[model samples]
Target: MTLKSALLAVLFASTAAVAVAQTPLPPADPLDDRSAKRVERMEKVVRELRSIVFQGRDTGKPVVVQPAETDAQIMSLNQRLSDLEQTLTRLNGQNETANFELTKANRAAADQKARADALEQRLVALENAFNDLKTQAAAAPAAGAYPPPPAPPADPAAAFKQAKDLLLGGDYGNAEQAFSTYVTNYPDNARTPEARYWLGETLFVREAYTDAAGAYIGAIRGWPQTTWAPDATLKLARSMVALKKTADACRTLDELTKRYPKAPANVTSRAASTRTAAKCG
Candidate 1:
């Protein structure tokens, strides 16, 4: 070979080697379009550089060529791609964590609602049970399950005296109960009217004016001629005054003076006071 031919061949070989060395590698991700396009452009630039070098050699002229991207710039782009991939992975993890927390919060809210519903149901059940107990308690007496009535006295006169003694001893509560039982058991007894009058005295002492008035009327029925009748008539008028029945009280006072003309001095004096209180004419 001639010396000039050998120099051209060496120059062509060196230029082709530089072009091969400067060619960039294919991108790691085949689906990355920008990287793939960059690699394709680099390859095309290398091919064009090789074509220019071969043409220069044929025409006896030197050709200069430069690479599209430096080594540092390529490395920087690869690092940026790796950072972008890592950021995507971190974002995906954060999204998963957020979704998990949201689901857990929803479950907790459902649990709280279920607990509240259970508590409300329990309260309703407890209220219903209390109402049932109240109903049963109210119905006990009607169903005949309550305590029985007390036994009747063996001797009606003896019972009447004992009840009178109780009243004299200041035990008005027991005296009232005893008189009430005596009147109920021996309704047709000779002393029943007097028992009723004493019952009215017991009720009057306790300020049960309406009940005392009723008992006094029961005692004075038919205007019995007993020793207690004059006092009973006076007490009936006083009970009527306490009951706010001024007209009834005046009529009762008039009946007392007409029926018992010689009532005891104390009873007549009390009757006069009661008539004044009642504004009797």
Candidate 2:
């Protein structure tokens, strides 16, 4: 063979062997049995090609011309190695794609499981709430089956003090009942206007704004000169605003400024701000 041709043949064989060696090996478990076997066979073929390409290298034969039959055998081995490598490449790509699809499917399954668990918990909460309500309804007394406790006695000072204590103690529900009872039992008491104002305050703290307005109105109109009167007027306007009765609240604030001209500076200032927020003319 010509010297240049022999050198070219050696270079080509060396390049092909190195390329095959650098090609990544297939993973042991890529979820495709057939692809795994193909990769395994490809690896064996690469090893055989390496043996053929460098067979006499240890004996100092980098490139050796063989008989025609040996050359044919080398060519056959090279062709088979090339085919095996192509098959391995295709199989590895397909395996990677299939693995990605499986990962997506697993993620979707986990997401569905999480949603189902959340739904089950919500259903359990709803069932528990319904059962509690059903039990409460079953246990509740029919109308007048149980009468309310006796009205607070008509001791004007002591009764009103008890209700006021309940208010200060943050027992707003009982304070509401106590104040209502006090107003009922001692409507003509000397502290009736103050009592009414405090009742409105109790309701206001409990977010019963409409009821608070009625009680405040009582304190303002029934006993206008009482110490509670100015504060009650202020609170009545605030309660009207809270109830979203914009016009009524604005009119009430106007009335507070006009009718209670001697009201405190802070009360007047707050009413002005309230008027602005309510967009009053």
Candidate 3:
């Protein structure tokens, strides 16, 4: 039998033992003395023939119980049965307490499992986001990452034309770079003076008057006979005036009017205007 059934059976036997102990024998007859004597015979027969049943959990073996003869024996057996009942009651209470603790433990474990599952889901989402960022980085390059490398066109005329076009288009930064490149790569080319003069133009329009003056001086010294030479000299005077060097600028304009006598009328008029503006002697 199951342990619960076994304990129940033991309890049932204990109850039966109590009932048997409580049974009253037949009462004596008042007119018959022998009938009263037969009461002792009835009691002895009950004591000899009586059997009780008990089973142990370990062995599952039935134990034969003898009936109690004396009052002391009966009382002792009753006390032990009462003690057993109290012990069983206490054991049952402990079992219920254990079952309750076990249920709470199960609930705690389930809650922890749920939290762990949620954390795992979040981790997976983060990993997917990281992978998406990695994919994007692989697909596209960074902005302003690669600059145009150093380039000097093979043909000096084409290069000069490109630099001049850039200057005319008002792209001063690239025009400066392109003209500077042309000057460096083709110093002896016939177009170099024109390129350097345009370089000064790029600087002058940007209001970098000091750099413009230097570029004009380079063109005049390097290609004095070129048509760009007189142009560069006039611009040089203007650049010096922008620098607040009125004396130098006036002397330059004076030299220009004398040295390049056949200079453009516009150059002569600009020189006169600049001389008047500065009150040149």
Candidate 4:
């Protein structure tokens, strides 16, 4: 009986303690709350659960996350850098090419100018050579061991004047010399036949029939085809008659008539008249 009453007493004490612990408290007014206690309680519970599951701890600092970069943004930056490098390389290549071409062109142009200058110099040298040759060709021939080329014939009028002057000075010897000189010096002179005729007259005046005949013969021979030929032949015949060369005189007359049949008939009449007047017919 004594042990049973001890156990009943311990049970009645535990029952009374439980009854006090389970008794309800008085309710607070909703408007009187100044904090979100319910939301705070839920956040505290989530933090505890996440730490236990992921971090292996119930109490520690919150986790952190870095922002991720987009693929298009990274690709765009790399492409821009590559394009810039290519542009720089192309510009450098173009500059080198332009410089090389310019140098080659300049050298070619200089070479061409040099060739032109050389050609100009050669032309000048040739021109100088030509001028020198012309100068040498124009120089007169060497000195006087050689006989001088014959002088051009004297003026006919001047020769006749000299002959008349010597005749008027009463210098028959000089007159003969002058007349002879005139004939020799002016073989084809226009006054040559007239000079010869005058020379014959001078010799006749001096009574030199042989010399007169010789001078008259010169007139006949010198102008065989001239207007003076017939007169000269007639005078020659007269001079031959005076020299007592009748056969020669007759032969000359016959020759004149045959050679100049076309001559006027007065040509022979004049020859006959001159011979008769000279008292030699």
Candidate 5:
């Protein structure tokens, strides 16, 4: 054989062997089930490769002769193709590993974001709770501060009724107690001045002139704008007269008439005034 022809034969044999070896082996069938979809897909790919090779052979562009050395050449090419296929498989494995890492990383990132959102929600809740606590504290009264008790309610009607009942019953001690109770219990009651006036009258009837005069003065001070004032003023002068303090009684009676000329107790007041003027003169 010619050297160039032999070389071409070796080249063609090597190329065919390389093509054959470059084809991947079918993946192992799971449980020997060669009828699975993956096995079918591998068969389809093998058929496509054989079809492409048959078409290339049929094209017949150049004449090349087979050489006696073609077997070794074919085997060497197949080994190279197998090496290339192994390299491609390794690259595919690396790609799949990279995709798996990417998926894991994405999931981790989502978890981290979820944790961050949860922490943020907790922080907001804590802030709101703190603000609510601050508001409650601001609304609270100062320490050591207490509200004062309200003033005791007055019973003016009850006080008057009890005083009148006492005076009518003629129990002097109980009557005085009732009037004093009225004064103590209903200091601002409208009947307080009247109670004092009655108290003075009760004392006067008991011949306690000084105490009666004091109570009458109290009545005048407590009920100055009322009709009881002039009556109490006149009674005060009477009380002084009973105590035999003529000059003092005269002065009191004179002042009573001068201060309250149109008093409802005008007759009694004027009469006392006249007696006081005569005695003093």
Candidate 6:
């Protein structure tokens, strides 16, 4: 090529190189420091080319610009830029993989927590159900253990008569049960107090002195003017003496004398014997 054409071509190429080097790089570029150093080297080369052109022009001499050197520099700069781009691509891929793994782990943890909570709720429900079943079992009566007593007759007098017949027949077990039913079913009946006294007799015969005392007390609660009152009182004192309650037996005997001044000789004699047994004054 001609000397002037060669000079013009070299100048144009150098100017283009400066323009490319001066272009603003994207802010997010990972190889910013290396790219800036490359730009600085390109600016120094441009300065050297301008100096060579001006010196050649001033001296009126032909400048030999080697095309191979320029081509080699451009090729080296392109190779460096390609390496930087590849590095940035690899880093972005690794970042995306790490983010994906972290998100998956978080989701797995959340799922595990949810399962644990559900299991805990199920366990709590089972425990509550077990407690409820235990409570129901405790409250319910045993099955077929003891049959219920027969129902009392509808009429109060008939019920009382039935209990009295059971007592007169010497069926003390059935008489006690029947008299208890009569007393409970017919509390307002005139015969209820007498039934209570008869229930005490059945219990006394069975040597259930504690229960007999309670039945006798219930029969004479208001000191009924019935024929059985004195007898029931004397039996109450005898029951107290059997229970080793000497003071109570004495008090009961005194109450019987005061309450029933006209008590039968047999009942009074029995009270006196009970007081003697208790060693009462």
For all candidates in order, the CA lDDT equals 0.84, 0.79, 0.78, 0.68, 0.72, 0.87
What TM value does model 3 have?
A: 0.45
Ranking by TM-score: 6, 1, 2, 3, 5, 4
Model 2, range 173-276, lDDT digits (tens) per residue? 77778888888887887777788899999899879999999999887774376555777888888898898998998888888877788888888888888888
**Over the full model, what C-alpha lDDT does candidate 6 score relative to the true structure?**
0.87
Q: TM-score per candidate, in order?
A: 0.46, 0.46, 0.45, 0.36, 0.40, 0.46
- Give the best candidate by lDDT: 6
The digit string of per-residue lDDT tens for model 1 on 1-281 reads 97567657766775776677566565783447886676567566656666765766677776665444666799889999999999999999999999999999999999999999999999999999999988998878465332333444689988898888788988787888889999998999988988999999999998999899889999999998888999888888887888899999999999999999988999999988998999887
Order candidates by lDDT, high to low: 6, 1, 2, 3, 5, 4
> What TM-score does candidate 6 reach?
0.46
- In candidate 5, which residue pairs clash? none
Alpha carbon lDDT at 209, candidate 4: 80
Query: Which run of 10 residues does model 2 get worst, by summed lDDT?
Result: 141-150
Q: What does the lDDT come to for candidate 4? A: 0.68
Q: For model 1, what is the C-alpha lDDT against the true structure?
A: 0.84
- Between prediction 3 and prediction 6, the one with superior lDDT is 6
Better of 4 and 6 by TM-score: 6
Which lDDT tens digits does candidate 5 get at residues 119-210? 99999999999999888778984642423322333567865776677678776656766777778877887677788888887788788889
Q: Which stretches of candidate 1 lie over 4 Å from their true place?
A: 1-152
**Per-prediction backbone clash count:** 0, 0, 0, 0, 0, 0
RMSD list, candidates in order: 22.2, 17.5, 27.5, 38.1, 30.9, 24.0
